[model samples]
Target chain A: MSKSAILRSSIAKKYWMALTGLFLCTFLIGHLIGNLQLIFIHGEEGRRAFNEYAYFMQHNIFIKVLSYVTYISILFHAIDGLMLAVQNKKARPQKYAYNNAGANSSTASRQMALLGSIVLIFIVTHMVNFWAKMHFEHIPLHTYEVTLPQQTNPEMVYYTHNHSLIPIQVDKVVVVRDETNLYLENTDLKLGEGYKDLHSVVMAFFGQSKNGFVTNSLALWATILYVISMAVMAFHLWHGFASAFQSLGLRHKRYTPIIAVTGKLFAIVVPFLFAIIPVLIFIGYVK
Target chain B: MASKTININLKIWRQKNANSKGSMETYKLDNVSTDSSFLEMLDQLNEQLVNERKEPIAFDHDCREGICGSCSLFINGEAHGPDRAVTTCQLHMRKFKDGETIYVEPWRAKAFPVIKDLVVDRSSFDRIQQAGGFVSVNTSGNTIDANAIPIGKAAADKAFEAATCIGCGACVASCVNASAMLFVSAKVSQLALLPQGKVEAQQRVLNMVKQMDEEGFGNCTNTGACAVECPKEISLENIARMNREYLKAMVSAE
Candidate 1:
């Protein structure tokens, strides 16, 4: 067969689905690892680690290329699925008078399109909420205080113009608000410079005030929605992970059961971890 | 086994031709023996219609056994009736109650157009098989010793399992998308697994898959109804195996 014919064929379309689906799964793992920092790291240290990680991801050339690939993969997977579903509907133009499809196939397998759409919506909302704000919109800089070693009575002070790195005496320690610009150049510490503190944004979005009241009802709702979206993601992955291998023609009786078990574990664990982040933040466990 | 007879109402789809409009025609069948097969019951109904000087309800059946893959009916919202793992011919009237009303219709797929009443032209499946369902062997007097090629038990069993597919359009009929992946995969896997067939496996998969697409069948989303509705109990694993074979072919071709 010709190359175009191979690609345009139904099996080729399924190959695209499987390839893109597996790629997205990898992206989810990386994303979940990044997000885990928000829960494991605490206080200013956690904030700085997450912010630096976010900054590195935003500026790194390799990561930029991966991000574009991720975007394209997401688009291709969604479009391919939509086209397949539409064609499927056309194939059966006349609906069955009675259908008990549930008896044969799984609920998850049957509802893949619906589950995928929900996840798609979640991706859009997530990108708009965090990614858009970090990249496109002007966001306020986060400020935090840190204790620093200072000169009590220095003879000579050798420092850069921004004073991001200050020469200090060994004897004296002073508590001061550390506003060092770690990512960008020519920035003032007092005025809060550099990239948006996405870590702080995440915290504020899901965090509650000291009085046990939510900072914003919208944030609470978004958290709830985020959790539900994770549930949807879990269900999508439950079928998708194993189906991907099948689509790729990786079926082996000895190893297929193992792959299926691993896929199921990944499907449940990844989404559960992601969902817990918002829950922990909402309850003031990770503030 | 002792058998009882029952009377029941049947709503069967009737269409004159592919281009003609189709509708449900009702018939009341009495004293249908529980031991009689579903198709036999239909035969009784047709006999009644014939005696009444009306057109006998048109349907398809050859062997009157399940192996021919000629019989197809969507009964009560399921392919081959409510019974699991049985074709319409294998289904018995005892499964239905005396007063129950059963709905029977032709497979609703664009590719398998209704010829008349319960008969559909499944030539699309034949074309897909013709595309690459065979291995080219030198048929001249130089036949190789069959026992000389030692095949593994597992590979042989898997190949035999896939070979059981009767090309029944149930996979297409039961599929929500009307995808023929199951049927195509069964044929592809049956040949791809054996050593004798592996020489032309690449071309076989490529040709069959292309033909399947040309037939305007829907893409497989792995909803899995095809394997379940299959009277032969063909496994979904065949589909996966074909997928692997196709991928291997595509890569090798490049």
Candidate 2:
């Protein structure tokens, strides 16, 4: 087949959809695992762990490449889906006098485009909320004080400052006050670092009464939107997970049932975990 | 068995040809027997029209038993009428209430142009079949035994199920997107599963899918109306199987 036929054909479009969709699913898993640290880890330690993870993800060479790939996958999936929907609409120029499609197919399968569009909107809003801030805006840094045990020699102290040791000096620990760096900051004092503090941002965005009335209201509204978006994601995944497999020509009578069941569980559990984060934070359970 | 008869009102689409504009023309018919098939009732109406010296309605049908798959009609917003798992020829009048209004229209799709009232040009399906719906087998004197190749019982059953598709085009009519994935997949799956047809599997799938796309059919989103409305009770699993075959073929193809 010619290159044009391979790429422009309906079957080709389906292959693209399936491949990109599976890529997005993998991204979802990685993202969910990182985000769960916000709820699973407790207090300052949790905040520190999450911030370090975030910093590493943003700065890591391999992760950066993966992130770029993720961005392309999302764009391709959305554009391909839009084109498919448009062509499909044109295929049936004349509308049926009556249609009862729900009788034949599942509601999720029929409404995939709608659910996908909703998810796209959610992704844009979510990126603007956190990702844009992290990448573009100059956000405030967190600072806190920490104390250490007495030291032995001047060379050791000099070595501590020069080497930028995390514990300062092993024998005689040095205390750093109002430290902004996570590595230099004392873990015992539960000190906040000066590295964007996304944990704090997330907490303020979902927690109540820390920011004024307007901020509180905004946080509540944002939490509701996040939860609703998670529900929409659930709907999209319900059909999409199995559909991606089918599109890739991975169907089998013996194993398809297992794949389908696993897909359903993944769809429910992942989104449910994501949705509960904001709800828990808002209700003061995660704080 | 003797069955009672009743009256019915029908609003049927009327089109002279492909280029002509069509509209619904209502007619009231009396004494429609409950035992009569939906097509039989239409025949009675045509007889009445002929007796009145008017142009009769043109509809398509061959092998009224539903195996020929020539019968194509949209009755009361359903392909082959409201009854499940049956064609228009098999839909008995007993399914409808007396004096109920019945709406009849042709299969609506860009690929299927109306040739006349309720009769569509379904040659698109034929063209797709021509693309690669066959196997290249030798017809020499030295013939292989019919059951020489051993196939698993499960695989054989699935191939049989996929082979039951009659190319009736109800799948297209019932689909909101007018997708023929069900029909194409049925053909693809039947051949892909059997050993005799597996030799040219890659080329066959690629060719058939290309032809289907060229025919201007909609992409399948797995909405599943095709399988539901199919007279043969074809399974959506066939479509999944075809997708697998297409992807495998594309990967291994030159």
| Predicted complexes: DockQ each | 0.71, 0.63
DockQ of prediction 2? 0.63
For residue A216, give model 2's deviation from the true position in Å: 5.5
Best model number under DockQ: 1
Model 1 docking grade: medium
Q: Which stretches of candidate 1 lie over 4 Å from their true place?
A: A42-45, A145-195, A207-217, B140-150
Report the Cα lDDT for candidate 2: 0.84
The candidate scoring highest on TM-score is 1
Model 2 regions lying over 4 Å from their true place: A146-193, A207-217, B50-54, B138-155
Minimal lDDT window, size 10, model 1 chain A:
A183-192
- What is the Å distance of residue A193 in model 1 from its true position? 5.3
Per-residue lDDT of candidate 2, residues A67-130 (tens digit): 9999999999999898898888888887766665666678898788889999999999899988
Residue B206 Cα positional deviation in candidate 1, in Å, after optimal superposition: 0.6
